[model samples]
Target: MTAVTDQDHTDHTNHTEHADHAGGQGHADAAGDDTGRAEERSENAASEEGTPQDGRSTAAGPDGEDVAEGPEPAAEAALEKSEGEEPEHRAAGGSKKSAAASAGKHAATGPEAPAKDRHARVQADSEGSWDDGLIARRVTEETAAQHVPTAPARPSPPQATAPLAYDGPLRSRLDALRELVGLSRTRLDSRTLAEAGRVLDEAASRRRLSGQHTVVAIAGATGSGKSQLFNTLAGVTISETGVRRPTTAAPIACSWSDGAAGLIDRLGIPGRLRRRPVQSAEAEAQLRGLVLVDLPDHDSAAVQHREQVDRVLALVDAVIWVVDPEKYADAVLHERYLRPMAGHAEVMFVVLNQIDRLPGEATEQVLDDLRRLLDEDGIALGEYGEPGATVLALSALTGDGVGELRESLGQFLAERGAPARRIAADVDAAGWRLRSVYATGQRTGLSEEDRDEFAARLAEAIGATAAGEAAERAWLRNANRACGTPWLRLWRWYQDRLDAPTGRFPARAQVDEEATARQRVEQAVRTLAERASTGLPAPWGQAVREAAVRGAQGLPEALDELAARAGLPPGRPPRPGWWPAAVFAQASMTILQVVGGLWLLGQIIGFMSPNLGVPVLLMVAGIIGGPLVEWSCRMAARGPARRYGQEAERRLREASAGCGRARVLDPVAAELLRYREVREQYGRLMGVPAAR
Candidate 1:
């Protein structure tokens, strides 16, 4: 009989426990109605008696007598029932097992066979189906999962995005630099754009280290011995120095090890890149990034060399001016170079080089005097609370105070690095000037009014009055040539009347006076060309008149003097030598014609009657005599005609040469000078250092 039934067990009861297992057969019977089907089937199989129940068996029915076992058959039928209900029953068992696992221990042991089956069934059941309570069970199961061994987490790969490429800014900057490079051709009048290009390149190169390097140039007048100081500071024979006034014709480079290549290259010095390691420990440490330039003398005869000095000076972070004892007070140096450089107050150093030549005790006095002169020149040499312009007495040959000079330079470099900002300012100023000339709303060229002024000046210099006189004289000569001799004198009378309207011909006294003909010419020139004031104080007005007289006096006197110098007579020849020859030939021809006619008449009479030949001879003498007398009168008139022509030609040549020199060439040259002055002034206003 079955002890318990499947329906009798609660769903929450532990399926793996002994009671569940012991009553397993009873519960199996309740689980299904097919309990004896296995035993009946087992008895029908061909089998032997006393077979183990662990083995499955079947017996034959009526055809053969294979008997079935009764007691084992009952047990097998119950097992079959439990086996049929195993899936639901195992689900029940799994819940109990999970509860036991979470409670920190196993709940119970069980009947060996059925309990093992139940446990196995439970694990398989839990994986197949989700119960409503499994989520809460999952939380407890999650804790158990943590105890279960887990694989370690793997690292992620690096991110993959597109590469960064240069945009327009860099290319645009490069384009601007290219433009500047192209502008090198414009270097003679304005290298500002090219300078700006160099500055841009330098800035870009040193963008990260802008405040670290200093470039200083030593610039001064010719004979100032700037090169000597340069060599002394550099501690090398970097700059050529000697008796020649301007030894450093080009910029010289002296720099420390760091970035010296760029500095030298920017200054456009090639083949001098051998780096000079700093010798002094202090200088080596403090002035690691300094570029010192030994610039050409500012007052050099070579304009381009001077220009190079000015250009490099403007771009440098600091300046050291070398001055000589003799010309330290020169107006040209102070006015043209130094005074205009007054804006660069902080970065300037003034050195009195070769001070050893002066008296030992007089150096200080001279320094004081020099400082005072600088002050007068609108330079504040020493101001309180300011880093005044440094004054050093140095003998470059003797190396006197050279150490001090180096120390000062090093200090300056340490404090104020290269003039990157100053170069930018200069570029900006130049751009402003160019913009003025090349403005957006306006076009630039020589204006009509200016052209008229220039033309007027040119006309005046040429002596419009003298040209007009020459033209009138030409008309007179042509008229006289065309007109009969009687009409020619009438033309002369007309000229005299016209002359009366003008003042009388200048006298010898007036021409030789203090304000002479030359003075009048110059005054006319000055008025037309220079715009000298007609209204002036007494002496200056008189002085202008005197200058005019001097200029005017030169032309006529020049002709006369040239003639005198050549040992020719003071005046033109009275007549051309050809005039007398022509007259003599005409006289000879007329006499020959008259004599020929007389001889023919005498021959004819002699043929007619020999006595009549005497009368014919008298007739021939009368004819010849009349012709000879007439020839004498014509010969006498030749002198006056030749004199007139010679004088006219001389006057024409003199007047024409004077007008061309004074008016055309002089005015054109003056205009060129004016253009140059204006250009220089514009450069000055714009703060362009100097064109290279």
Candidate 2:
């Protein structure tokens, strides 16, 4: 009879008294007809069957939240019906040993479960060759399953959408990680990337160039049954199996077929722990190029054990986290490993081992809860972890879901994705950690407006106004010396000498006067540096600040030298081209005055009759011409002097501004450039798409 139908397995529960006097045949008939119910009397025979192989108490756990649902538990009741045509109508006969041996024999060659995931079974002979079924005792207890009424397929676990293959997520995540790592090589903390890169290179090189096997790590907390699962998959006793805490101190490598020496050698496993599996055609053929390692407990009390786990974790192609139903919700497992490596969900597998210990209903319930926690940890499942992370439920000691795991490893190896995907996850993790320093949005440099303000302040510090005024006055004085009336020119020159020394610089006092403005120049540089440093990482900003202030000690002396050199053009502008004309006009006027004066003297001596008229006319002409020449020269010199002075002032300011730019603004600009460079590096490190 089909007692282990998917429908019957759905509502597994612990109860009493399923073994009745109705005999095994009658029980099978009733199971086919009535779905099981969890009355108080279902587990009568199960109680006497012996200890459950799950190695834990078979009691219901506290009701809790939704969990990460793993693969359905393999059903055990597919073939428990009586063999002969006649109904052997009798209660379980003889000692409990015979009943257990009989149950193992039936399951070893049992019919298939309703689901297609069921593996072909190896039959047991009369002498008790029953190693193929779950723990012998558990199978013995399940023999009376037909007598117990079960709920019809409790609830088909929410049918998962078709499995999402790892193509998109795996490739995309890897590319993203590579780009981020390349950018971060120069900036951010290299220690993390260096460690990650070393592992990446080692893994990718070994897997690709060597064309070797996939290195899969079986990891878990102590007592999670990883060793047993590892040995079961290998079909041999390669790893130690025991109840002792922290049983495996070193990782053990098990290779399916012989060409994996290179891959295992790179993993650095000791020769003693590494063993080649005995090849079996029906078993693990697909895992020919696979290297499966059973690692020490991740939460081991020995620091070395934890360290070994971490080292191997960083190097492996993929990691299978084997957790028991009891400690599936462990914080150390989820936080330290799962949550941080969520970017690598593509290459991670979560196994809920020892599902046989939980009754069918509790199995599904706990699986769902585990899934919920994985969701919180950012691990997705399904074909590609799209809907949820891939979770498997199996019992290593019972040999119950081990075959499916072996097959999955075969499929994973054939895809040739674990190494790239694992590295991609690493890069993703490193990028996330540096987000604080690398997330600066855009790259920019100091603005022209800011530079101009700084330049103006530096010009002030160099005393441009003092130099420019002196230039203008000097130009005016030279013009006056050339064009002024001869007698007054000497007097004016002498008078001007005491009144502020036109055209000559160096009051020496002007240098002292610039002290306050020098401080202003320094302040301007600081302000510009501060503005440029905004939004940068602390190191970059500090570097910019230091660069801006580097030449502070020599700045004052440099400014003073620049100020002294910012003098008027030598000897002022040459005398106006028209000055000679003014001199000739004045000379002619003097000659006329002399001639008129002589004529007047002749008239007074009575040397010529009526000469007084000519003398008087000449005298008047000379008098008018002299003053007119003087006025004309004065008017002409006014514009030329003013223009020359303005030209000199302009030149002085240009020279002063240049000095300021070189000593002050230039340093500020250098700092800004440094800031822009670092900012660009930050963008690259963060993997921001727009950093150019």
Candidate 3:
């Protein structure tokens, strides 16, 4: 571009624009050379802009009139700027021509002094003239002009807290999802996978565990004293408590440590109330990592409040489900939350709140009834149960069971890994839900018998049997053409040609390549799919059926192509070492017969001495031997031809079956294998040997 500017417009003002816009074209024109273009842009833009706008007189033409723009401020400034950039434009070893053009541009942009003085100044500054001075000065001034005063460096943006790293339980859950997402949604229970995915995302986003915080929520139905319980546990009024039906309208959190700010922020619990527990007791110190949240009533009339409870419930590490004696065994709580969260029983605590309101015997009864409901819900209870969940009777109002509850929370918090355990349980539950998809009580892979049967069906479909019979006939026909008795061989060869006017034999046998064949292949595929899908769930069965017929498109054409390419089992019977002997024996027999007949005729006609006995005996022997030789040759051809036919049949069947395997059976097997793999991955995610 710069070179084009140098050649087209002698003015140096467009140097930057030309170099940027047409650099490639210029380089191509310059034969991959750039130094010449750069030098021209620098020299021409600087030397030629001697305009009146730049405050310099234009150069005189032969008539002494102004020829071009003179050194106005802008012109002089541009010329000087270009001159400063001249050295940068030059290559390490610039050509003499470039240097000359630069020197000429320098001389043209002379100072505006009187003629004699101007000449003297040009001579004085020839080594570093006004051309160089002006270029350097302009370059410096423009560079300075581009500099803007940097404002007090703007304050940095608020740092965004990245979500928790995916590892351990989160990683396992994601890995299990690999198979679940790929599985047939009809069988794999997509709802469970979706829920598990949401849980995984929650774990990643909250990142409380990494923040050294364990978020334990206190959730219960209305009038369950949940907010009061939360306050008693924290030893401060963190949650609003009143006689109001819905005391807590949102999820209020209380962090026992300073590091839980990020955790609280992520939970979206900004305004209700937050407090730090005083370490007056050793238990409080032990509970330092705990961040307790008092959730809105699960059965609240407001949908938003209920939604808040649910949202907080999923994200929390553990739960203390507060229940009064009146609603201790409420089916709503069990069916909605406890039953679904059975896998997370280890982190759950079902507290019989307001125990102070009940008599000793009544309190025991309510606790037992709660236990029964929990058991029925499949929640493993900690006391006298599976040790996965705990049952406690407490009065947040009276602080009766609060101490024991606090101690439990302290111990759970000290473990410093409740979040991981909770996340793992979530994954386990999802895996359990999907168990039917994988654990169908049967092997998932295709058996050899199944494969062989399918292949056989395909072979039948493509008419391998007919092709084999054709191959046998072809081999036999050729055999007779070459090996029969000499006269018969010629006659048979001619007879074989009678059917071939153009001397081109028909195809041994053509595959039907019709819908019947396709239907047969489909049937074989369906059968194989049915067998493979035994004991599999309905969705997987359907999937297997679909997979079995995955590549049905253009199947007939594929079969035809394969058949055409698959030649008959090679059998050139004449190539055998003994075949020549058979032909020779037959030929010899014919010769003997001819010779004996001729000799016999001579004796009968009395052309020679009487030797009728020799001639007649020779003739008889020759006749018998010729028949024997021909019969032997015929007998020899039968075994090889039969064997060859059978071999050809086997080869054709194999080729046809192979095509079936590639186009149909293979895809079906892949689907089954995918199911198996997902099942295995789910098992691993659940931390089990296999899906139950």
Candidate 4:
């Protein structure tokens, strides 16, 4: 049997003993053959209850050892009844012992014993030993046991902080820039939104990585040893240094690797990457994150390369101006580039490179002269004692004073002010240019009253009213003669139309003089209109002249319109291009009427026979009537003709007013609109209120 503790097997054995005692007693009473019954019962009990510590419920052989824990222990009387009949039982016990065993078994066989059988024998035994009423108490005690503690609740992750808004004066200027850009139809001609975006992006990027590195550009004239100095400072051949002028055709960038990609990208150079120092370890450490760009000569023979240098130099954070002993004072370099860059003071370094070529004492004198020239160019270096523009003596080819140059670059980069400042500077510069175009303000269309007044003034200046009066008088003079008495009528009509009237015949003097006077007046009015328009602004001045032409031609055009409306007969028209001939014809028609009337007057005065006089008068009247009718028709149209002239002049003035305003104001308004868009975008990015 496997090992079992005494507590484990005790309960099953007790139950088996009680069973044997009860069975022995019951049989002994019924049959009255105690000894034999007891012996047989002992044998059965031994068979039923085998080894106690084995997995058996009773004292049986192999089949009986099935229980995991021993059954409950036997009461005293049950133990005695099985003692003698078998080795385990006592056979000497009388009926009283058997009866006592039966009674003890009866008590042990109560419900508590079966309940105990459900548990391990040791547990059952211990429980059986307790009062039967104590079982509930034991379960209650076990249920009351304490639980272990748990961990504290963890905290949630935090949200990211937003970018701080820019609340400075610069914001207002940016707003204006956006307005200006909005004025453009497609892409802005000058300051585009792309430029604004670039500015913000550059600023934000620099701000984020501020205090990390400084970018310095080595800018100079074509023949200066800028590349040599760049190479010397880097302590290796980072840039191509040569004897030939304009050797560095592209910008060469050298940086200590704290991510120079952004700078390189901004410079917009293709096939150019960051290079490490090839020579001096100290220079590398001192200039860590300090990028030095060796620009192509600004004054290069090739125009494109010069432009490339100028473009990149504008965006660099700092500049190192390399001056040589020979061509340090070139006027073009000083005037074109250096003077213009006077606003950028924090990052300017002037290096008198190749100082070894000059004598020691002469070096100081030359350096002083260079300083004076720089000052004249508006590049303010420090005074005699103060830290002004950094001027250093260095030989890029010989590696002299390169360490100091590297240290200067290190100091500037170490300032760690973010790129936003540089971007702000650029934006400010751009804004100044844009502001110049739109310095005035928004403009709407011209007022109707103003246009009306202008038109009226133009009409008065051209004497439209006077022209109408002159045409009326001319037509009246011609009409009176045409309607006069056949002999006198024809004669009187022509004479009345002319300046000098005659009694017997209409004078050619009246017609000739009056017609010439009308011509002179018309010519004078036309000249007045042209003169009035002379001092007006462009397009407007042209507009007024055109209007005058429109007005001057209005009478003829109106006549055509009236004739078409009135259904008048089409006649052989006088050609406008043949002004000299038309004038002659008009004068001749007046002369013809006078001559015909005088012939009639001769007959009326009785200088010929009655028959001749009558026929001659009728023919004379007919001949003069056509010229008189045409002149009358032109005079009747003069009122409308004058109004048409006035109307044409008015229209020109009105149109010019609007056109002038549009040219001046519309573009400015568009720029303002674009600038507003940019301001809104910037506000969203920076989480700030847009400037008004």
| Winner by TM-score | 3
Over 4 Å off, model 4: 1-167, 184-211, 244-246, 269-273, 278-285, 302-304, 382-389, 398-400, 417-692
Q: Could you give the candidate ranking by TM-score, starting with the highest?
A: 3, 2, 4, 1
Residue 495 in candidate 4, Cα distance off native in Å: 30
Model 3, residue 118: displacement in angstroms? 82
- TM-scores for the candidates: 0.34, 0.64, 0.68, 0.40
Q: What tens digits encode model 1's per-residue C-alpha lDDT throughout 1-692?
A: 10111211122124224444544444344433332343443343314445533222325321132322122443343344435343222222234433222111101111223433333323322322211111101111222222212111111232232221223543343344344334333322344345445555544554433345576778888878887677555443445667866666677666643434444555665433222322334555655667777778777899999778766665566788888898888887788867765655566788888888988678887788888877776665645656456777788878777778878777666655335434434444444534432222322223456444543443333343343343334333333322223333466678877775322111233435424544544544554333331322232234434443444444544533322232212333234344445445444544555666566676676754435455556556555554454445445544454444445444534544544356343543443333334344434434453231
lDDT for predicted candidate 2 compared with the true structure: 0.57
The alpha-carbon deviation from the true structure for residue 222 of candidate 3, after best TM-score superposition, in angstroms, is 1.2
Report the C-alpha lDDT of model 2 over 470-528, residue by residue, as the tens digit. Answer: 55566666655665555567688788787865456545565446678668668877887
Give the candidate number with the greatest lDDT: 3
Candidate 3 structure, TM-score to reference: 0.68
Candidate 4 per-residue lDDT, tens place, 1-692, comes to 01011122232234333544453354334323333334343444535555232212443211123222222233333335433332111111112333344323323333223322322232222222111011111111111121111111111232232332344655564554454455432433433356655565555555444245567789987667887777566543445656777688788676654345556666765332344343124544566667678898888898988888878876777788888888888887788877776655445788988887887697888889988888887666855655447788787656677768767667666655324345555675555443323232333223455444433443333333343343334434333333223455556656568855322211223555445534543453355344543433233334444544444443322322322332211332112233344345445555556666666677789885545555555556656664555455455545543454344334433433333233322333343344445445444333355444
CA lDDT, every model vs. true structure: 0.47, 0.57, 0.61, 0.48
Candidate 3 achieves a global lDDT of 0.61
Candidate 2's TM-score: 0.64
Of 3 and 4, the candidate ranking higher by TM-score: 3
